[model samples]
Each structure stands twice: as C-alpha cells, then as structure tokens.
Target chain A: MTAMSSAGHSRERHALLLMLSVLAVLAILHIQQGARPIPATVMLDAVLSPDRDAFDHFVILSLRLPRASACIVGGAAFGAAGFLLQVAMRNRLAEPHVLGLNAGASLAVVLVTTYQPVVLPDILMPFAASLGAAGLFGLVLALSALGSGRFDPVRMVFFGIALSALASALVSAILILNEDTLEQLRFWLVGDAAGGGAAAVWSILPAVALGLVAGCLLMPQLATFSLGESISVALGASVHRTRIAALVVTALLCGSAVSLVGPIGFVGLMAPALWPRLHQRPSLGAFLLVAGSGAAILLAADILALGLLAPTELPTGALTGLAGAPVFIWLVARRLT
Target chain B: MTSRSADPPTRSRLTAEALSVGHGGQAVVQDIELDIFEGCMTALLGPNGSGKSTLLAGFARLLPALGGSVRLDGSDLATFPTRHVARVLGLLPQQPPVPEGLSVFDLVARGRFPHQGFFSQWSRQDEAAVGEALALAALADLADRPVETLSGGQRQRAWIAMVLAQETPLLLLDEPTTFLDAAHQVAILDLLRDLVRRHRRTVVCVLHDLNMALQYADRLVFLKEGRIRHVLTHPSQCDGRIIEEVFEMPVVSLKHPQSGLPVFLPCASRQPEARP
Candidate 1:
C-alpha cells in the first residue's frame, strides 16, 4: 500500500514538474518573438538589467513585458473563471464567453466609448465592463431559476446566448450612432494588447488577485457540487450559495480579463476543457495547470499573430477564435467518436 | 443556533410533525408524522412518486416544511443553523452525479466541510474520519481511484463513505441500492446494517426492495401516496396484508429458512370473480 501511494505521488509530482517546465518554455518563447524582437540573450540581459540600451529596453520592458503580462494575468483569470463556471453549473459548455459575460463587458465598453467618452479619463472602462457583466450574470441566474427552483444548466446557457445576441445588437447600434469613433473602438474591440500599457495591466490586478483567492477557497465546495445539488447538500454544502459565489468570482475574473484584453474569445472555454485530460481533479494543482496552459496559449497566439504576417499584425483575439474554433471542433469530434 | 454542547450526544431523536414538503409552493408530501430514534435502522418503503424521497428530504431539512416542523433533539429544525444541522445529520440522495476525475479520498473528505472552518481546513480529526469512513465502506483499496471510473456498486459505496465521513448521528439515504446488481444490493444492505449495529448511527433509508428492508431495518415506515400507511417494528409484523396495502400488489409472506426473516413473494393476480 505504501509503495502504491508513493507511486501515485511520484506521478503527480512528475506532472506538476512538466507543466511548470512547459510554462517556463512558453514565457521564454514569448519574450523572444515579436515585431522588432530581441534575441533571447539580449532579452534575458534586459530583464536582469533595466538600464540596458534603449532599443533592448523598449523590446523587453515596454513592448513585450506588458503584452506578456497581460497574457499571463488575463489568461489565468479566464481559465480559472471558466473552470469555476463549468463546475458550478456542472456543464462542460458553460464558459464565461459562452455565458455572455464577455459580450456584456464588450458592449459596455463600446457604449462608454460612444456616448460616455467624457467619463473615460475619470473612471476606468474595465470597471464599467465589470458592472455590465455582473448585471448580465444576474439576469442569467434569474432566468435559469424561472421554471425550476434549482439552477437549470440548459436554461442558463440558452438565456446567456440570447443575452449575448442582445448585447451584440446594442454594441452594433452604438457603433452606428457614433460612426466617428468606430475606427478607434474597432481596434480595441478585436482583442489585442497592441497599445495596452502597464496601467491597463495594473487596473485588473486587484480583481484578478481577489478572484483567484476566492476561486481557490471555493474549489473544494465546487468539487462536491459537481456531484449534483442533492449530493452537495447531503455532504453539508449549500449548493445555491456555492454556485452564486462561483458565479460572482467568474464574472469578476472574466470581466477583468475582457476589460484588459478586449473580450478575448475561447480562452475561457478552451482552458478548463483541456485541463482535465492532464490532471485528475479541478483541485488547486489542476487550477494552476489550466491557468498556466491558458497563459501559454494566449502568449503563443500573440506571438503567432505578430510574426505570422510581419507588419500586418493580425489581432490576437482573431487568432484565438481562428485557432480555437478548429481545435474545439476536433475536441467535439473526438468526444463524439 | 442553540448550543449542542449542553445536550447529551447519545439518545438523539428526530421526529416530523404534520410535515408537508414540496417545491415551488406545490406540496408533494403532506401530514407526515414519524419518529426516528437513535441506534435504529429505519427503512422507508414505497413505490415511485409515492413521496418517500420528499419525506426523507423533509426529515433532513433539505426541503422546507410547508405547514409542519421537523424536530431534532426535541427542537425545531429551523432553530438550528445549517452547519449545526449538518453536523448532526447527513444525507445521500439517489444516483447523484460524481464529479469527474475526483479521487475517492477527496470525495469522502468533503464530508468534513461542516466540521471545518477557513483556518482549520484539513485537521487530524478530518483525516481520521475520512480514513475510517473509507475503511468502513470497504473503499480503502480504491481511495486513490477517480470516482467516475469506479463501478456502480463501488461508486455507491464511495458516496456512502462520503456521508459516513460526516460523523453525523443521523444518516439519511435515498435508494442506496438503486443501480447495484442483486449481490451488490445485498452487500450494501449488509454494510448499512453493520454501520447501524457497530456505530450506533440512526439511519433512515428509502428502499424499494421490501424483503431487504424487512431483513435489514429495525423499523419499517411504509408510505403510499405521500401518507404514512403503517409503521412496523419487526419483520414478522410486516406480513402479506401490509405489503399488499402499501404496494398495491398481492404478495405472500413466508419465513426465510436461513435467516428466519420474513421473505415476500408476489403471487398470481387475483381476478374480481374470485374475490371469496
């Protein structure tokens, strides 16, 4: 028995090591590949010494640093949020984007840029987005509880889809009303870190930190809840309370990510969907694995977006959708078979 | 929240008075008054849609009582906080979905949630409870295996282990043998009996198999159409008339030669013309 337990422990340790190494490799690759990119050696030296040459400094500190940091922070938030949503709802398809949170945040941002431009300098756009996302989440929760006292997964997904379409329509209306600001909003709406400075990254740090802490605390409860509401209750968990807490955390994280990266699609859906294949449970280790995987995917996509067609600069959100769609399709097909 | 420390832990009792339970303001079970004492394994037997589960839910305080009250330790259930109630009572619903990729050990460890606080997440007591539960359920061998990958019987045992880990005085189970094979069903019933005998835990389980209930339970509460038809104390008291009345099926009760318990057999249908 001791030997068997030791073997299982070793396997878990090996998996953890592998995930950490992969994350490290992705981080290094992210720093080495970009427009006017520096070599790996120069990037490392610039990271170690901030007072390097202006060109190396620009490549390392100004350009690559913020973008990579955004990927790490934004991706971790999206992945953790996605996992929480799926576990809380007990539905594999229930990602923050699919549940209309990203759409809600995007629409709110578009509205701010169109009609409330004067308020932009005074208040951050992400805060507005968070409010919008929370509102939409509340609507979904109410709709889900319409017929059944318990939260119904199918009804919630359907309501989210409908709300997403409505949000999209509102965004389109705003863009049409303010045609002059359409070009400026268009670039931000497409999900890219092209001009996001350290300020934008810092804006979401508190939300991300709080969300991660809450998500970790709720992990054990969510694991029990995934068994079903009755079992959760029997095991001394308050299913409704746990789900609400999870939803609030998900909204905060996804809203913050969308605020920073402009509604990056598929990261939320893809991360949790992929993590279980590598790790056993959605424990803290699995959470970290999914977060790291999400960061790696986004960072890699950013690199590909920049390097694929040099000087053309395809938006990272477009690349994620383009890349995520086929991969998602493949996953579905695999499941079907 | 009343202080449970002031009261004696042993001899705890649960009773429901005119309890009506339902969802969305629609009552499914009405006027249920029953007493469940400590150290007794009570089986709630009824057909599907007979509100056996609803009654058990009411007793466990999972469903809100529409008109009456469930009293634990002679106090109204509502008087206790959720955590206090949880520490005293544990329940296992029917065929609950297992979280994918959750190991059996972690799944059972969740039973300690009521006993834990934010700072005292994983304590020695919790570990010991989990270990004892796994051993009691005969799942120590599969502790590291994901619950999703286990067989139906093993999964059911693992779930029971989770409830056992709660260390509650009262354990309520809804159809604990639903998906098991015949042998597995008997094994689970035996295990439940052992738990009641060895641990002195008060158990109320919803059962479909009348014979198993008769053999395993110290008390039998039969329900029909949400009303308590009869409560029998001994297997010999559960004869053909009670079974026929509650289940709406004609059956013959005979003594089991091996265990000397009451065993039931469904005879041929009685025609209207042969009513004599």
Candidate 2:
C-alpha cells in the first residue's frame, strides 16, 4: 500500500509539473506571436534587455503581458469559484454564468456606463461588478431557501436561471436606453482584455488572493459536504457554516473575475464538469485541476482570438461563448443519454 | 445508572432523559428516558412513523430536543462544542448520497477533520484511523476505488467505514441494513457486535427486523406512536405482550435454537378479507 501510494503521488506530481510547463510555453508563444509578429529570439532579447526598442517593449510589456495575466487570473478565479459552488450545492450545473453571477455583473456595468458614466472611473468597474455578482448570489440563495425547506440543488439552479434572465433583461433595457453607451458596453459586455491597465489588475488582486485562501480552507469540508448534510454533520462538519463560507468564497472569486474580464462564461462550469472524469480523487486535486485547466483554456481562446483575426481583434469572450455552446450541448446530450 | 459509575474501567455511556424530539414546532417523540450502556449493542425497534429515526437523530445531536436533555458522561449534550461532541458520538443516516468520483480512502479520511487544526490538515493518526476503518469494513483492498463504482453492499460498507474512522466512543446508525441482502445484513450486524464487544464502543441502531434485533441487541428499545412502550435489557426480559401491544399484532416468543435468545414470530389474523 505504501509503495503504491508513493508511486501514485509521484505520478500526480509529474502530471501537475507537465501541465504547468505547457501553460508556460503557451504563454510564451502568445507573447511572441501577435499582429506584428516578433521572433522568439527577439522577444527573449527584449524581455532580458532594458534598452530594447520602444515598440518591442510596448508590445511585450504593455499589451501582451497584461492580456496574458488577465486571462490567467480571470480563468483561475472562475474555475475556483465554479468548483466551490458545485461542491457546496452538490450540483454539476452550479457555475457563475449559469447561476446569473456573470449576468448580474454585466448588468451593473451596463447601468454604470449608461447612467453614471461620467462619475464612475475605470478602476471602480470590477468592484461594481463584484457587488452585482454578490447581490445576485445572495438573491438566488434567498429565493431558493424560500421555495424549499432545505437547500435543494434543483431549486437553486432554477432560481439562478430565473435571476440570470432578469439580469439579462435589465442589461438589454439599459443598452436600449442609452444608444451612445452601446458601443462601449458592447465591447465590455462581450468580455474583452483590450483595455485593462495596471490599476485595474491591481484593484482585483486583493479579492483574488482572499478568495483563493478561503477556497483552500473550505476544500476539505467540501468533501464532507458532498456526502450530504446528515453525513457531513455526523462527521463533525457544521453543514450550514461550511456551505455559507463556500458560497462567500465563490462569490468573491466569481465577482472579481467578472469585474476583471467582462462575464467570461463556460470556463467555470465546463472545467468542473470535465475535471472529475479526468482524475481519480475528485476532491481537492480536482478543484485545482479545474482552475488550472480553465486558465489554460481561456489563454488558448485569447490566443485564437488574437491570431485568427489579426487586425480585426475579436473579443475573447465572444470566442469563448462560441466555442463553449457546442460543448454545453454535448454535455447536456451526455447527461440525457 | 448504577452500572455507569461501577464501570469506571470501561467506556463512557450515552443516556437520554425525558427527551422530546420534534421538527419546526411539531413534536414527534415525547418524554423518553433511555440509557445505552457501555460496550453494548442497543437497537431501537419500531414500525414506520414510530419516531425511531427521530429518537436516534436526537441522540446524535442532529435534531434539537423539544423537551428534556441528552447527557454524555453525565454532562449536558448541548453544552459541548459541536466538534467535541462529534469526537465522542458519530451518526450515519440511511442511504446518504456519495459524492461523484470520490475514492473510498478520501471519503474515510474526512472523518478525521474534527480532530485536526487548520495547519494540521493530515497526520499519522488520520492515516491510521482511515486504514483501520477500511480493514474493519473489509474495504482495505478497494481503498482507492471510486465509491460510485462499488456494489450496494460495498458502498454501504464504505459509509460504515467512514463512520468508524471517526473513532467515536458511541455510534448511531439509522437503518444501516436497508439495501443489503440477508448475508450482508448478518455480516454487518456481526461486525457491529464485534466493534461493541472488542473495542468497547456503544452502538445504537434502528432496525426493522425484530428477530435480528432480538438476537444481536444487548437491549431492545421498543417505541410506538412516538412513545417508549418498553425497554428490555435482555432477550429473557422481552415479553410477547409488549411486542404485541407495540406492533399491533399477536406474536409467539420462542428461544432461538442456536443462541438461546428470544425470537418473535408474528401470527396472521384470521379475518376472511385479510386472506388471499
């Protein structure tokens, strides 16, 4: 048993290292291959030397680096939040987008852009988006709890879908009310990494860090919780307390991610949906894998968006939605059959 | 009560006094007083809607009391921290939904969470408890297997192993033998008996099979209409009158040929419409 566990541990470690290395290589390729395609050697030199050309430094430091970091952070946050929600609710369909969190954030952004555009600064967008997400999350919890005597997974999902529809309606209404803000809202709503500065990134850093730490703390209790509330309580876990903490962490992560990158859908839902099938122990390791895989998928999507339509510059969020629709269909089909 | 203070060298006992169980202001069981002795297997026997499960949940502190109190080692159960209470008492509900793709080992390892601090996530004691629980349940060979892939009996054993890994002095099980076949049921009952006898763990289980309950249980708590009809400490103490009154049927009480314990056989009423 000891030998077998040791071997399994080493294999898992090797797989994790390999995945990290792949992510690193993909990030490098993303930096080196852009519209004004710089050679790998030149990109490396520009990265190493301080006196490189202004354009090279601008592409490497100002544009590609921030975009790549945003993709990583956004994907990680969504993936972690999705995994936490699924475990807490014990439902596979519990993702921020599916649960109205993304829609809520987008609606708040739309409201700010349409009505309070002159007062709201760029750095405040993510915070506003987070509040929207948290608000919607709390609403879903309250509505579900009202309907069911206990926290039923099916009721929670239905409530989230209803909230999502309402948020979408509000967003569309705001868009129609202010035609001038439509152009700005259109780009932001579709989920783009086009114009985030160092300030925007720094603004969301604390939330992301706090969410990640809380997620790690709640992972073990989540395992117990998945066994049902009775068993969790029997195992000495305070079911209500653990579930509330999980929801709070999820809201923070999803809210921060939505604020950073406008309502990137499917990464959170799909990463967790696909992770258990790939791993042996679908507990903490599965959560980490889903987060990492979400990051990789988003980074790859951004690369495709950048490279496929070079000068046109499509929004990464639209590409993700397009790519994710068919996968969602397939998942629903698999679940049915 | 006298046996509790006399058994200083044995394990602690779990007892309830005038316990009334309810949910959301609706009382189910009322004014119950019972004692589960150390190193004994006690079975709560009742028909459906008789409040057996409600009583068990109250004993485990999963359900709040509507009236009296439950005492653990002569202390109020409500005064103990949830974690501290869990370290001494463990309860497993019937047919708990297992998480998808979780390994048996990982599921069992969660039993050690109450004993662990934030920084001390995994320890040698946790590993040992998990290993011993797996061995106890005969699931050592399938420790790494996903619970979803296990057979019904194996899955039930895996859940029992998780409860065992808690290392509690008292264990409560609500209908642990629901989905098992006869052979598996006997195996699980024998296992529980051995745990009580060898490890000095007090076990309180709710069972539907009166004959099995009579054979294995050191004490039989018979409940009817949310009230304690009678508590028989030994098989010889179980009278046919008590069984008939509680179960609403005539029964024949005879000594078992193998164990010499009293066994019950319910007789069919001689009504013309009741017959096929």
- Which candidate comes out best when scored by DockQ? 2
Q: Candidate 1, overall lDDT?
A: 0.79
In Å, residue B270's CA in model 1 sits off its true spot by: 4.7
lDDT of 2 by residue, A214-274 (tens): 8887776776766777877777787889888888788788878887878888888766665
lDDT score of residue A206 within candidate 2: 80
**Can you give the lDDT of residue B244 in candidate 2?**
83
DockQ values, each candidate: 0.41, 0.57
Q: For model 1, how does the per-residue alpha-carbon lDDT over B1-276 read when each residue is reduced to its tens digit?
A: 011122222464998888899876788888988889788888999888889998998887778899899999899998887878889999998877766667788778778888987667667888889889999999998998988899999999998999999999889999999878899998898888888777778889999888888778878898889889898766567788888887888888789886677899998666546546
True contacts kept of each: 0.46, 0.68
> Which portions of model 1 show Cα errors greater than 4 Å?
A1-16, A117-124, A141-155, A277-280, A330-337, B1-12, B270-276
Candidate 2 has what TM-score? Answer: 0.92
User: Where does candidate 2 stray beyond 4 Å?
Assistant: A1-11, A112-125, A175-183, A277-284, B1-12, B268-276
